[model samples]
Target chain A: MSHTLVEINNLSRFYGTLQAVKDVSFTIRQGEVLGFLGPNGAGKTTTMQIISGNLAPSGGSVTIANHDLLEDPRAAKNQIGYLPESPPLYRELTVNEYLDYCAALNNVPRAKRLSARENTKERCGLHDAGKRLIGNLSKGFQQRVGIAQAIIHLPPVVILDEPTVGLDPIQIREIRALIRELGRDHGVILSTHILPEVQTTCDRVQIINKGELVLNESIEGLEHHMKSASLTVAFHQSPDLQFLENLPGVKSVHPEKDGRLRVFHETEQNPTDAILRMAVNKNWGLYEIRPGRLSLEQIFVELTSDAALENAEALATTTTTDSGL
Target chain B: MILTIGIREFKSLFLSPLAWSILAVVQVILGFLFLARLEVFQLYQPQLMAMDGAPGLTEIVLPDLLGNAAVILLLVVPLMTMRLVSEERRNRTLALLFSAPLSMTEIVLGKYLGIILFLLVLLLMIALMPLSLLAGASLDLGLMASGFFGLALLLAGFAAVGLFMSTLTQYTTVAAISTFGALLLFWILDWSGQGTAGGNWLAYLSLFNHYKPFLEGIFNSADAAYHVLLIITFLVLSIRRLDADRLGG
Candidate 1:
């Protein structure tokens, strides 16, 4: 069994009267990259802050490597690293000087501080920018410096908040690859609203809506959710709707706007073979038949839209109760 | 870890134009004050020598200059210390320290010490202007030493108060303004007491009241204790403010 590196149980946070995070719970293990997904103000950053021991939750506890964040924060924090939404770059210092300070701040021993700084700089691809002041460097290099500081102490868990917020496409891809590389050894939790980032780099994804965990599943499970055993097929001629509906194992059939038929089969059946046989025997031209999979954007829209509907209903009921009261 | 933070803070101070500008303005004003006090002392030297038990050059020049230095520091120390934690919060870099394995005490002490070191450097330069008079006259070194010691204590206390104010707000201007206001209040606390009956406690709490003994070449233990207590109080308040931030978030 994989070792649990960070465990959060029923965590909640409130900014005065506003409930920012409510009863959120999740566990992250060694070698697992957990993608924390949420809309704006969905408590992703707050949860990450709690896990990093930067913020105290109103109600629940966080344990890092069996040490409680509140009871033994030093030991717990020593095992976790966090990069907040902003990179936190000290503009006046050179990259080398900033990283060295971070190394010492994270309790890297005097004997090992130099080597650790060098190694982290190399890992974050900050080799050439070491001599340049952070203020003089571009945003991309500043971000790399941010990552270098987070991992200089070699913690077991690293939490990054929006590590790729304002980067070019190539820079975003590089940072994503770097995150994936870090996940190979450390339990990495990154908060991002970018859906494709999760599809590419995350092993598991947790989507939170209104401070509640709405979806938590592996990437494979996400793929399966999108791949509903449906097929989009097109023919040279439009076939009878009744004949298509009467096909074996055909659960539903609908004609799409682009002159193709969307056929959803029963859970246990693949109707491609039966449809292919009938098309050959009847001499009906069949051009294409491909497995259907929803884009991550579509799935995200669907999930959040459902959540929005529930939220609207909840608001309506609360308003009605308020009026009755 | 505290040394690391202190070094970073001290180094950043030199890199900013604000620190340089503060240093230049302060040294120029204090230098001008030093010259004015020296010319006045020289003009009265013969008369002062004929008087019974007249004060020497150190007694006449050093105390007045250091007193002016202290008053000037009342306005300038806030500028030096206003960015200690406020700028870190503004830039969101305080999270780096919070998320690290550091206690709030380390952060507060490190930053406080960093600014104190810079203020000490300023104090050293101002000390040189007074010591430059050694080439022309015989100076009482003991009296000068006491005056310098008092200025050190005053600057440390001022730094602590400024640091606490910085922790209260993310806007550096607010921190600087409120710190100036706080120091100004303490400076005149004794003056306000002079008008009221049975307000000795207010005078006792006055920062200048504690500092005045040192300026007069008298090392009173009670005066020293007051400055120590003031520094400790502000530093403790700063540490608690940072703790509340972690908890409140």
Candidate 2:
């Protein structure tokens, strides 16, 4: 297994009475890309800032490469590179000059600073724009410069907050490719609200809603969750709802318009084979039987929407009533 | 780390047209004043030669020229120092430094030293006007050096105040104006206490009062200490402000 590069334990931050992050904890291992997914104002940026040592956590701790962020900030910060929401560029400086400054600031040795800068620029596709002033470059090129600065020191962990925002589609694709490339060697934490960006780029995904981790799963596990757990079938002649619900391996049955029935089942007990056999034996002319899958977008909405919270509360009250009986 | 940041800061100043324009304007204005003082010295050279206690070219030209330079710098230093921290905050680039493996003290001191380096170059240019008198007549190097030293100390104090003010706001204009206001208040502080009973402390508190002695070739430790103290105090405050930002209020 790859070694853990960043360990954030119970990290919390409060802005006066408003708690921005509440006991958030996660770890990133080397060569893993962790997608930090959240809705707007979900405290993603605040958490990124705390992890990068730009802001102190109101409670809890963060360790970067075994160095406690609060106790040994210099050592911890040295092990990570952060690109904030807005790329921090000095508009007047040339790309080469800015990269050189970043290298120096990151303590790349004097002899190796030039190589570090050149290699970063080349990797970020800024080779030809070395002489151009950053202010004059296109937004895409400027963003590359921002990324170049972050990885110039070759830190073990790289944190990028909204790196592809405000870019054209082509630029976005290029940056995503670069981020995936970085993930090969570095433990990368990418925070974004874009769902596909997470699906296409990350090995693991974490969803934060209302300053709390709503879901944490590996990509394969998320795919498994998205797999069809329910089946939708239609009949020329409608079958009894009670019989459909009582079928082996079936969990519940709900009737829909056009004489269709939706049957849900357990994860391991798929009811498709049983339902097909029963429809033929019972003479219920089944025309359409399709498996239902949940898209990531729906999952994200279900996890983050206010309706989800209310649904959870309603479920809790019913469970209490059942237990009381 | 401080040198790396300082060098970058100094180089960045030249990348903007503001620094070049300020340099050009200051040189033109101070150069013209230097010539005017030399002309005045020539006009009174014969009358002074006959006097018992005659002040020579160094005594007459250096103090007036350097004093005018100080006043001009009083206005210009704020402009130079205004963007030191405030622009970084406004542009959201301070995060670059904050996330780097550097302490607030290193960042603050590096910026301070960067502006001081630029001011030292301006001071060298101003000193050349007095040193040119060495072509024909004997010059009092001690008095010239002391006058320039006083001006350097005064500019250092002004820069510290400007940096502190810059840390107080994200707006560059606000930083510049507040620095001007604070420096102006310190400049004329002694005036309010003049001729009043128990006003000696106020006079001592005034930046100009301490600077006045150095212009007269009086190397008083108290004046030097005063300027150093002012520099340290404001720098410490600036550092504290940055720490507050990191910890969040």
Candidate 3:
């Protein structure tokens, strides 16, 4: 097993009275791409900032490569390369100049700074635009320069907040591929609200809502959750929904407005074949049938909304108890 | 790391038209003022030849030229230092420095040094106007050195104030205006205190009061100390302000 590159324990942050990040914790081992999934204002950026030492956490600690962030910031920060949500670019600087400056800032040895810049530029597909000023480059190229600066020093852990945001489909795909390639050797933390991005680029996914982590699962486990346990069938002729509900492996049946039946079944016992056999024998004139699976978007919405509801209930109870007191 | 940031900041300034325009405008204004002083000195030369222990061309022209340079720099330094930290904050590029393996002290000092280096170039150009008298007229090199020394200290002091002000806001124009307001107050502080019982300390506190002795060719350690102290205090405040940002932000 690879060694852990980052360990965050019970981290919390506050903006005045508003707590931006709650008691959240996670770790990233080398060669792991951990997706930090959250809706807007769910504290993903705040957590990333605290880890990168851009912001101080109100509680708990972060350790990077065995160095405590608060106690040994230089050593701890040396292990991280962070690309903030906006890329933190200097538009007046050319790509090579900016990357060289970043390498120097990261304390890359003077003798090796050039090769580091060259290698990082090559890796980020910035070879052709080395001499171009960042202000003059396209948004995609500017983002590439941002990523190039982050990784120029070859830090052990890279934290990217919304790296693919505001990019075209092809640019997003290229960035995702680059991130996956980075994951092979470095522990990467990719923060975004884009659900499928996590599915494609991350080995593990974490969903945070209302400053709290609601779900932490591996990609394999998420894929299992994504498997369809329900099927939808539209019929040209109406059938008794009760008969379909009584079929083997069928848990329940609900009729749609368009005269379709949605069949919910147990995970291990798919009722598709049974329903098909019944439909054919009864001559129900089934016109369309499709496997129904809960999308990642739906899962994200459900998790976030559920967390919000729970927080509201908890807040209400606290207020009521205060009144009772 | 400080040098790395310092060099990048310095280079980036030249990459923008603002620095170039500031340099050119200051040079033209100072040059015009220098020639005007030379013309006035030429007009007074014959009359002064008959007087005993009369002030020479250096005494007649250099101090006034240097004094005007100080005032000109008072206006120009803010324009230069306004964007030092504020622009980084505005563009969100400060995050790059914040996340780097650097202390706030290093970041502040790096930027401080970059602008100071640029100001040094401006100072050199200003000094050349006085030195040009060396071709024909004998000059008081000592007085000229002290005058330039004092101007350099004043510029450093102005830059420190400007940099600290830059840290307080993300808008460069606001930073520039606030810095100008602060420096202007320092420039005329002694004016309000003149002839009053409380004016002695206020006069002593005035940046102009300390700088005046240098233009007069007197190098008092106390005057030097004031500028040094101002530079150090404002720089420390800047560092603290950035540290506070990391904590409170």
Candidate 4:
């Protein structure tokens, strides 16, 4: 029995008439690295903001570690850290000075600020670049500095919104590794539209569409959802629809005009068992039974396409939000 | 805690080129004003010294010295205060300050005190003028001391207003422009006869009018109370603006 670290209940946000987060509710268990997935404007950032106590929810409530957000915000906020889409770096100061300032701001006592600074520097890969000014650092290093500021106070929940929006491949991999490392100790909520990010880094995935939680499950469940298991069998001779449909555990069999049959299997029922049964009964030549895999890109496209997302601003508008980013 | 914030703000004000520039320019102008004022004193001191033991040094030079400082403060105090919270917010450093352990009151007070400290340093630099005047002329000590007090109170009120404006936005340009406009209006709009013609009561409400008593080296309790009240009003407004982001209550 794990204690819930963050519990959001019926949280909804509206920008006047537009509903950003439509009744979003979820509980994040302690030490869980939950990935928040959605196309732009699917309420990922809004939900993240609510969890971090940065944005006020239009309805419902958030309780962090049993401290109600509306009642005991200070205590709740003290436990969570938030890094916005932009790293929020001070260009004039060196990485060390900025982090030290953040440390003092986050209430690291005078006696402990040095040790906290040392710890964050090591954890965030800033040990070698502390003296370098943030303006002079590369994008990746600047991002690392952002992470350092967010986690310098040893917060239990670190909310990162689009942490890898503008990074190269190698930088993305390094940041992923860093996120995984942080997840070992801190409960991290990472928001990104990049699907592979979830498959690789998240222990659990929640996909929201049109401000509604369309899918809320573990990473394996996501893999299963995207994994098209049942095969399509094209036969040389025709088989009766009833005979194939009567097959045990065959959820549905759609007969193609070309004498082929597409089968749907209940996730619990193995297609292999029913396929063997079909072969013995039909005595028809089985031309091919190929496996199908839905790439993360395909699933993302399918999940966020015009018919799917109902709001396809990810293409034209996320760019608008990135000016400051 | 307020003192700590004040010291940090004081350091930041001095470290910035703007503060240094304002200090130098104001001091030079005061220095020149003091020289001309000494000429007038030289013309009149003979008669005064001849009559019943001349009034000591603080008298003759204090008005011109204080008058020049008043003009200088009206020009520079707005610039000194415009960037306080506005720049922090513009550079995104305000978030760091917001999340820090210190409350908004401390930040505002610290930054306000820092501006006051900067003004004091410039005053000290200007004090050199009167010290030189003392070598050759006579002026009243009480009058000079009162003039400095009046100037401090006047600038303190202006700094408070500027600090309030800084909290209004994340754009330094907007903050600076609006603060300048607001102070300028306060300093000159009384000529419109709004405060004086059928609005004598409203005229009394203006910060400059309240501060005029201090400039004359008169420590009126009503004037002191007016400045203190205005300062508290702006500080409270700043604190409320900061509380907008806190979770719930």
| Global lDDT of each candidate | 0.90, 0.92, 0.91, 0.76
> What are the per-candidate TM-scores when only chain A is compared?
0.90, 0.91, 0.89, 0.84
Model 4 TM-score (2 dp):
0.85
Each candidate's chain B TM-score?
0.97, 0.97, 0.97, 0.86
Question: Which segments of candidate 4 are over 4 A away from where they belong?
Answer: A232-247, A252-262, A273-288, A295-325, B1-16, B51-56, B99-107, B110-117, B127-141, B189-199, B244-249
Write down the RMSD of candidate 3 (Cα, Å): 4.2
- Docking quality level of the chain pair in candidate 1: medium
- What are the per-residue Cα lDDT tens digits for candidate 4 across B1-249? 566557666776765688889887887777778778777877887788789866544655676567667767777877888888887766755555544345567767777787788877877787677766667555566777777777777777778888888888877677777877777677664555564556565566766676666656788999888878878888888777766644331
TM-scores, each model vs. reference: 0.92, 0.95, 0.92, 0.85
- The sequence of per-residue lDDT tens digits that candidate 3 reaches over residues A165-213 is 8999999999999999999999999998788899899999999987999
CAPRI class of candidate 4 = acceptable
lDDT of 2 at A157: 94
Question: Model 2 residue B189 lDDT?
Answer: 89
Runs in model 2 deviating more than 4 A are A256-260, A306-325
What are the iRMS values of all candidates?
1.1, 1.0, 0.7, 4.3
- lDDT (0-100) at residue A196 of candidate 1? 90
Clashing pairs in 4: A105-B100, B56-B139, B57-B138, B57-B139, B58-B139, B58-B140, B59-B139, B59-B140, B60-B139
Candidate 2's DockQ is: 0.78
Better of 3 and 4 by DockQ: 3
